[model samples]
Target: MAVYVGMLRLGRLCAASRGVLGARAALFRTWQEAKLQSVRPLSSREADRTSPLPIGGLSYIQGCTRIRLVSKTVGQCLDATAQRVPDREALVVLHENMRLTFAQLKEEVDKAASGLLSIGLCKGDRLGMWGPNSYAWVLMQLATAQAMELEYVLKKVGCKALVFPKQFKTQQYYDILKQICPELENAQPGALKSQRLPDLTTVISVDAPLPGTLLLDEVVAAGSTQQHLDRLRYTQQFLSCHDPINILFTSGTTGSPKGATLSHYNIVNNSNMIGERLRLHLKTAEELRVILPSPLYHCLGSVGGTMTCILHGATLILSSPIFNGKKALEAISRERGSMLYGTPTMYVDILNQPDFSSYDISSMCGGVIAGSPAPPELIRAIINKMNMKELVVAYGTTENSPVTFMNFPDDTVEQKSESVGRILPHTEAQILNMEAGTLVALNTPGELCIRGYCVMLGYWGEPQKTKEVVGQEKWYRTGDIAMMDEQGFCKIVGRFKDMIIRGGENIYPAELEDFFHTHPQVQEVQVVGVKDSRMGEEICACIRLKNGEKTTAEEIKAFCKGKIAHFKIPRYIVFVTDYPLTISGKVQKFKLREQMEQHLNL
Candidate 1:
């Protein structure tokens, strides 16, 4: 007992001398070890099934490998909202069956900061928020940013990466770290890989703490009072609008992942825009609910979906650990969900269910879908029959906080179904001629460019790559093919580079794909144009039918009758069961196109 007390006193003295104290906390290492020693260890699968978060200080270092920002960007947004709605329920994990009010969330965030500081974690640390849609995961992201200090930290946010370990153990973490960064191969133990990664000395796992990782709660308990409060103030003051907020690694199914650098302003404003579009400002809690099946690493999942729900004082209902059609509809009904927002495939997944209506979705307010050009008929089913008349069509990229354009609730049936809607109130977009930055004539389809609050900072560790996408004036080259009409409404046709030129006529897959979405038995579909001999190119449809359903090319062509022009319909149809998707849920249509071309012997 004397030895334990003596060590605690010595650690406190050392902490005081270093000026890294938060709220005085008991070092939890001894306590947790004792507690855990008493409980039987669950098998790896059972442990995973219990908690999605990694159990360590890995959250502290998740995003810090390349520190991007300086202030409490999103955290401040939460604070501002919490000031007015302190008692409002901000987060709820339906499966965990736990809810946190804004004030309660603040308290937990503060405690997390204190814990992070008690350990050697300083500013510019990488803390991974890898988990299913859960409250704790969200809290880890904000809290790490809040506790950043000028100590031995390098980066402040985790450059987004997938958790490699099926189950993490502390002893083997160094081995795991190698898997994370093969470049660290030559680095000496206990030293950073480089000065560019200053303050990126730790990896805070949000789930099971690995052998080489620091247990999260233990760090919190070990932190001194001064380090905690100083971090709180640092977070409140350090985070700013232009400061980097998130470094989302574009899912690299196509190629190597590119790090998309999002600013606090980008994310905060993105959420604000969605809230504004939906009229979701500080609404009463019970009257609002957001249901989605996307992972938080995706732009739509973070800025538009969860943050919008949090800002509006609404409850966020996470749909699944994995995409299950039955579970999605059930979550909506179980939560009496007001809003269902996700990729077009998500909706298709639900509709494919044999008994989608079995879920109690009577309380749904409507839904929003992105990821692909939504079939208008699918939109009609979600909004009209599913009773979500207020559903909207929104468009964006990871570089734009994932939202730049949106459809308004007031849009007519045709407008809502056809156009991607107008530029958001604070966002501006222009069509650029194929050559240079020339503004295209009104109603001319060309490259879509945009700039506004929601634009990201730049790409992390890839200045050349960033410059290629974003212009000198911060306008992002969206690469999307779109035409703004006389009313300033923007209709996305397809990607500029993705356009198919058959003989002389230009074919945009999205426009043609919309026609396929209306088919009754077409559960999911992607339109891609393949090279042709005389025509230069020909269109094809990679189709997925609903369960217990069948579709023929003739039947699909008939469904497109009158609804689409003759040349726009896919000449080739290949049924598929799955798609290659990015972390954000966008299909890798290019890959699909390649496969289809091979199948067709084109």
Candidate 2:
């Protein structure tokens, strides 16, 4: 995180010193106030085993290494399970010919480690795993863990040490490597122009070999497993609970995207808490077979998928490169996946498929859907039609390992239909008045503030950026507008900045879009505020009609009548084939806004 901040600082100072200082001062003030809000130091109750938690009392709840390094590292977590469930099938990589047991998977991880260590790769160096989620993808992450401990899991490892199975040979990779890490300065040496990182004293490849990167397989085979195993053990001794795994890229409402640094302890604990609440094999270790087609680059499929299954001695099914609806559905059915999880968009696509009912979706337990407000209609499809008993409406950000709220246990049908649910075990939430810069009371719509163990280490290389989002006491200002009921259920209304004011009335697009989703022909709809001369701004609906169907603006407007207020209905509707999205499958409203404004000549 310091690296990013330093670069931004250097860029600012070198480009324009006076403007840079002023911007920094303003940012620092915004960050300082946020920090103060986080560290308010509130009192709380302690939860543990025999403390009413479903999981056997949490062993690491009150300690720094509370969750323990082994429990957190993907390789270490799988290894622990390998020892206990040696014969149990731990992973089934699609098109890989066979299933790998816990023991076998650990061996693969060890091989990758030996390969890196043989080439003189030191501990705590960053290793980039940029390939698609596959058997080797999991292996790469675990293998890299053996060498680097927990310094870089979700983010790019910064030492320019190792690149993953695929997608790193491009110019983008080279630029990022050299720009982020100072070690690679003056990287383009003689014979290195076509040369892929000849400057790295040592580099290792995963599955295939690159010109400059050392072959991981060859290196691993040449060395002694016992020696590499000992080195792993030695590094594990110095592995602190809070060490970062990797850098994750997440979008900000205002900028391109920023890197979120996630630590081992944060990822592990959050997953543990999730498992406990869901009553996932709390009594005894069960053969919980989990299907993860959500992609390994993401927390939902990687950390959450791995930890949730491990907490119960379950197996992780990796069916990589799950393209569209058909691929995902096939993988889920093939694995007899017990539970499925992904963003709301992915599930919506799955449910909306023409073959939705054909698959044996009966084994699904439940799923967590975020990245956008989940419509009540979609939740009903997952629970009733899809046979998923636990359709949870969750909310969080990448900065917090992307989990903060779970549905309240005693929530009524109406509450669940209207809200995202309650705050999670180790987190606190409050509604902030963004305009007044004050915390608001219950039932009020305001910016949501989250603070807990689930929060990220910080933005990788951007300290000033980190301080801006993560306030004191570690509360992260989500920039999302929400409301907290008296029962503590936090319901997302929209992004704090997403409110489209039409003249004097505030129109939340999510609320209006919900009504449009109720229409049968409307497969997907995005609401954008278009600049209007008469109303200041008018609601615009970007609609994607169901296959072989169509709906006009007039008909859609009629359907929305009596469903929402008069002023909240969209004034303009434009049909489109697709919506622009972020990496996590979140719909980019800003993009939609730009598209509509240009179309209407505003």
Candidate 3:
């Protein structure tokens, strides 16, 4: 059968321009299906092994087989949930005083999808949905069934249209757009001209109208006609699970962010499994309220929180435009929110609120703590102070639909603190020995790898770079060094690249950092390796001391003398107020290393 390629331009094709351009569809490899088809039948004796690949003393595991996958597009998944509980509460924007039921949300989404169609966007067209967490943001995400780039990401992915806020607090999105497209000031809404962004044709603004941009409300209204509504349905009807529905940019700590293109299959199944692990099945059919403080641009918010909530017919509560601990606490108290999602730092801030005790967080039964390592102390505080008895920790990257392993609610506090839980359903994880090119034994540290539907379609337009990590068998090599226990729980030890080799001894920085966090005077710690001509790389620890506390590098070294191996102990200690962080709140270790190298003249 011949592959049908859709026209590249109509990701937002004007109504008048529909038939002027012929229908087109790109030919996809069909490799995934072909790989499945080529699987050879196993002999009775070989069937006992389960997996087709042979292994050594390596640690490898797959999720339970009993649970089947939900085969549907992201839009269709929402449609199913909305159909099941049309009158059920779907979204609550506490700060905005906005609420919507499943039926109402679906109606808005349909109208928005139609609006997109009326403006010329069609199936397979790239649309940039950029903004904070809001009801409209959620609508736009599903309406297009595909979603950022500041400029490079947009142009790299060939974004045809953009839907963003006029200004997010102080960030002037309109001004930035104008800088990129000087002609946008005079061009019509659907006829943008830009030397920098040649593929961009339309700009849709939220909340209010901007010069040379169309109001979001007008776009929705334009699609109110029956013809446009049918067009929206037609677009949804033809979408495939394999088609790319979203493009998430990786945190560019090491270099430029790679656009990890994800499909409906990649995220829909992942989120569904995540919901299952959270015990958010809603068998009683009652609404579960989840307060999300993470930005919608990140996968933790978009897929793990938003998409997961929709899959289970739960209410998603956006507490603030950005993370505000006080507002998050208030939303939980006032809305009786049962679930919460945030990074470990966010939870720390929430617990640090002076009046934190004043809020009634007794309504919270469970929550997800992710984005960064969940220190045991932080997890315990969230459990004890926040009254979240069923808190679970998760681990994954943006390239893996953001969630592959999640703790079961009933998991012991110790289990939750020590590991990132078992693999999610239908996913596979393995620990490969870095030097020998083989899987390692249980509890042995090695590079962690993941393979499943969640693996991305490869970095957008960078196949060579994509191949460097993702292998032919489809295993995406996570740079993280980890170990899986016999029970299948995985512990992230460190990053392979971040490992310190001092005098031929491998020293994992996370292990030292975890040890330093135990020190009473140390509030935060990051251990990095500084280049040294003598030992190759000497260990250094950057520490943030507790309030009103003072300590010397000698005292820190003395504390570690008898506790950990002498070689494992940091050779140098530097006290500081805070570590440099990325916009997403991850520590810029490379920056820390550079600063230390320059200071010490390494």
Candidate 4:
């Protein structure tokens, strides 16, 4: 035993010295052999059933699995909604001053579909959209929605055509395209042979045409002139609910984003279900006007915000091209918007605006505050100040067409604020012990796993990677640590991978962040672990203070000293003006770690 220990020390010493390349190579080989000897790989069948214990009892809850799903195509759903409410306003772009009733919107959608078909785009063809939300954006989207669900990850999924804006505000999208396809300047609109993007044959531009891109209006006109009604009808007739529509990239807070490909059936039902949760019914005469400020690139915006509104014959009001608090406020007041959608940070910013009280947002009765868990204070403030009395919370990932859990209307303030509410109909969730990989008892903190109609087909073109998160029995491991009550309410605690181990102590950063949020100066707080040589990892707190508030790191530590365990107290504290967030409004903690590492020169 002494000789083995001495040999391990000698190998480490040799590997650390630059002159001993041969010894370093030998040491690495020995380490690899040791690792291989220590671990055994699970068989395919064993891996599928993660629970060694039985599947029944307190470990799982199948959410209304017997409920029937909407078995219609996206286009069919839109057509049906339009038929039911032809004269009702279907969409309103407040920024563009464009109002289209259901019938008019359907007409535009059919024309756009015909235009896409005329331009050689067929069923199952990939079309990429890159721009902020607008009427033109919606037209192009629904046009594509007729045949296919537009995916978010274009390059990874290898889209056949791309429809993007020539420019949006300060962003020159065309200029970036020129960099990728230098020959785009010389190539024809429909026949592009670029080295960078070989699969791309067509480039369609919204608002205006670029040198190598076709104009959107021209596409619509081309379809109008073509004798292709039969062809469009043929494509629609053969379409199925199970067909792949869109591939949304999971917001990569910890690692590289994976493309979660969703089917038409997946999104259509998910959107309708979410809409139902919002008390929207197409049969009702009361118009549900929704003010959406989130981006089109994410499921939160595309599925929950836009598609849900369309499915329920609700009038969707786009506040602005991008989220502007002022524009959102104005749209809600002017349009008499009954619903509003945004993240907690967005709501916080809107609440912080000095002239916020000046706007009359009395029309807003309900909306969703999703992407992250909303603080209790933020929820109360939104209800009290923003007039969102029926405001609820939604929780899910991009992989599930985005919503698996939601707070329903009848839920009390404490239930809505403390928990993410009950599971959606036709879905199933389970809590598995993180270390044991077996089912845990109810109310025990464990990894949350989901299975249902909402789960994506898989990560696009990466079956192995897809298999890693989604088990063989079709359960997609959420990686979120959560506790489920007997009544089925779930309180998300933290990420499984995000769990911090400091000197053998398990620490969940979310708990620390939640406690820190109670501090008077803290507007927002994110806790992460930094590498430490003495311990495995040390807790670091990154905080965004409330406007005009002042506090020191020492003050924060002093506050935590007596209230919480010493092991959980953040050793490092940082004050920042803002946090790095994904387009969907989720904080990118990995970016924070990188910044902290750079700041500490670790």
Clashes of each: 65, 25, 16, 1
Model 4: pairs clashing at backbone N, Cα or C within 3 Å: 149-245
Model 4 alpha-carbon drift over 4 Å, by segment: 1-57, 65-67, 142-153, 282-287
Instruction: Pick the lDDT winner.
Output: 3
Instruction: Write model 4 residue lDDT over 1-602, tens digit each, in one string.
Output: 00000001111111111010110111111111111111111111111111122133575776653335776555666666677778989778787788888777666656556666677765455555565666765554421111111222444556666666667778787787777778888988888888867767777776676788888778767655547544555555555556665555666667767667666577777886787666675225444888888765566766787567667777878888777888888888888887888988888888888798888887778889888767777777888887777888999987888899888766888888788878887788898998898889888899999998988888768999998988889999998999888677888888888888999998988788778878888888888888999998999899999889998999999999889998898889989888887655678888888888788777
Superior by lDDT: candidate 1 or candidate 3: 3
Q: For each candidate, C-alpha RMSD in Å?
A: 12.8, 10.3, 7.6, 15.0
- What is residue 576's positional error in candidate 1, in angstroms? 1.8
Of the candidates shown, which would achieve the greatest TM-score relative to the real structure? 3
Q: On residues 1-602, what C-alpha lDDT tens digit does candidate 3 reach at each position?
A: 00011112122221111111100001000100111111111111111112222234459887765566666655566566767777888778776788888777666655655666777665556666555556555555521111223676567667677766777777777888788789888988888978898987887777787877888788878766898767655554445566665666676555566777666677777777777777676334433889988766667876787677777777888898777999999999888888899987688778877798899877789899887677676677688888888899999988898788778887888888888877887789999999897989888999999998889887778999899999999999999999888677888888887889999999988788778878888777888999989999999999988668898999999999889998888878888777766555567788889988987777
TM-score of each: 0.78, 0.79, 0.88, 0.87
Ranking by TM-score: 3, 4, 2, 1
Off by over 4 Å in 2: 1-76, 142-159, 166-204, 222-224, 251-254, 283-287, 408-415
* lDDT tens digits, residue span 1-602, model 1: 00000001111111111111110111112111111111111111110001112123111001011112212244444555566667877666665576677666655555555554455444433333333444444444321111111121123222211111223223343354455455444543233343444333443433465533445545545443665656545544433345443455554434555556555456555665567666664335665778867655565665566556544556667666535567778887877787877778777677667786677777876557775677787777777767787788888877777776677666677888877766664566767787766777667787888876667667656779889988888778877888866666678888876788876888888876776666667777777778888898888888888778876788877878787778777778788888877545567777877888888888
Q: Candidate 3: which stretches are off by over 4 Å?
A: 1-57, 142-149, 282-287
Q: What is the C-alpha lDDT of each candidate?
A: 0.54, 0.54, 0.68, 0.66
Worst 10 residues of 2 by lDDT: 6-15
